[model samples]
Target: MANLKELRGRINSVKSTRKITQAMKMVAAAKLRRAQSQAEAARPYAERMARMLASLGQAVAGNPDAPKLLVGTGSDQVHLLVVVTADRGLAGPFNTNVGRHARNHIRKLEAAGKTVKILTVGRKGATYLKREFASRMAGEITFQGKKRVGFEDANAIAERLTGMLEAGEFDVCTLIYNRFRSVIAQIPSDQQLIPAELPEAAAETASGEAQAWYEYEPDEATILAQLLPKNLAIQIYRAILESAAGEHGARMNAMDNATRNAGDMINKLTLTYNRTRQANITRELIEIISGAEAL
Candidate 1:
């Protein structure tokens, strides 16, 4: 029932919106490619490092002088959750998924009467957590101003975590992030970092499966002491990479959907416009003929 002028304005507005959505979709697609590649490239190294750390952990399992990072602080009364998410959101449920997963974990911990603390790594996660866990939030970090994510960012986060641990801020620390599985699929994952959960391989290495005993130049304790902190930083870096890739993938898919929907809407609107215009023209012609007949 809209007049031609009103309908024309609506059509123009939609067209403008369509253009913006299309541009965003293209940008997301381009970014997704590079992000995906980086995520994929980092996976093997992170996995291998985890395996090696696990093997070493196994080797040192029986040693009384094992590194504190490996053995932990002997209590789970206090818990720290490091939740990572994208700094920006246009990405459907990407940030929401990560936030939800962290919230679930927090709820479970709280139910068990454990003290919960939060360290948010991105603005989205911080915003989400602030709604419910504001009191528990220990700190927030954002990469908004950075041109590119780097190891230094991860190191800074790790340093903060390590400093807190050394200061006896918390007992157990867990990291939550989205793991990029494929373009259409991302899995929310939770990993324990503090008290460093040695992978199965680490346990195997400790069992001495090899025929020859391995000797350490600086001693196992000393090596592990250094490796443990570095491993924590590496793990954080890997998680951030995974999250970044997943965010882009989600955004690309979301924008693609938006663009398609906008196109469909435009089509529907054009159809309506044509119908309205035709009706108006037919009405005008009939009025003219009636006037001629009256004359």
Candidate 2:
């Protein structure tokens, strides 16, 4: 039962909101295309690198002299969770989904009497997790105001993780992020980084194949020593690309929904404004008729 003036104000406010949402939707859509392409392009190489590592490391997996990145620190006492999220918001539950997944993972680890540590990649995730897990934070990295996420960013993260591993900070390291699935679906995923989770299929294929003894120009151990670090960076880069693409997809989907909702609200408000204005005009006409009749 708002007055015409109030209804007009409400309608104007909704119209302004609608314009902003529409603009955001368009911007997100434009960004999603580039992000999606980059993410898709990075996947095959990343997968191949992982498979190669799995096949190559099959021989030395049980060796005590193997690289720690491939063999881990011989314990599962401390766990490092690399939680990745978008630096910005307005992306529906995109950030929330990963945050919740990480939180649940931490709780499960704690329940099993395991020590948990966190390395957050985005401001949103750091802010979200610090509410309940302030002390467990090992580090936080944010890339706000950046035009795009690049391989260098991922390499920097990998370097930090490597440094932490060398410092004996954590036994096992896992990366959690949103994987780009489609425009409307970004799946929360977790991948073990340290101790490089090798694919059994690749290992079995390599071991079961009856081929000539192919010797490495530089031995398998030498190749693994060189490839392991690069593989680490590549894996992290893939995660970042997937996360970037997923963030854009989520934001685009969210903004599209918001724009549609704003349009609906504007329509409803316009109808209400028209009804209120008509009621006011009829009331004024009735008042005039009443006065004329009295006269």
Using lDDT as the measure, the top candidate is 2
TM-score of 2: 0.95
Cα error of candidate 2 at position 152, Å? 1.8
- The regions of model 2 sitting more than 4 angstroms off are 202-213
- Per-residue accuracy of model 1 over 1-295 as CA lDDT, tens digit each: 9898988888899888889878888887888888878777877878877766765677887777776567777789999999999999889899999999999999999999999999999999999999999999999999998867988889889888888988889999999999889888999999999888777653554767653456776887777788888899999999999899888889988888888888888899899999999999999999999999999
lDDT of candidates 1 onward, in order: 0.87, 0.89
Per-candidate TM-scores read: 0.93, 0.95
The candidate 2 region of ten consecutive residues with least summed lDDT is 204-213
Question: What's every prediction's RMSD, in angstroms?
Answer: 2.5, 2.0
Clashing pairs in 2: none
At residue 125, candidate 1 shows an lDDT of 98
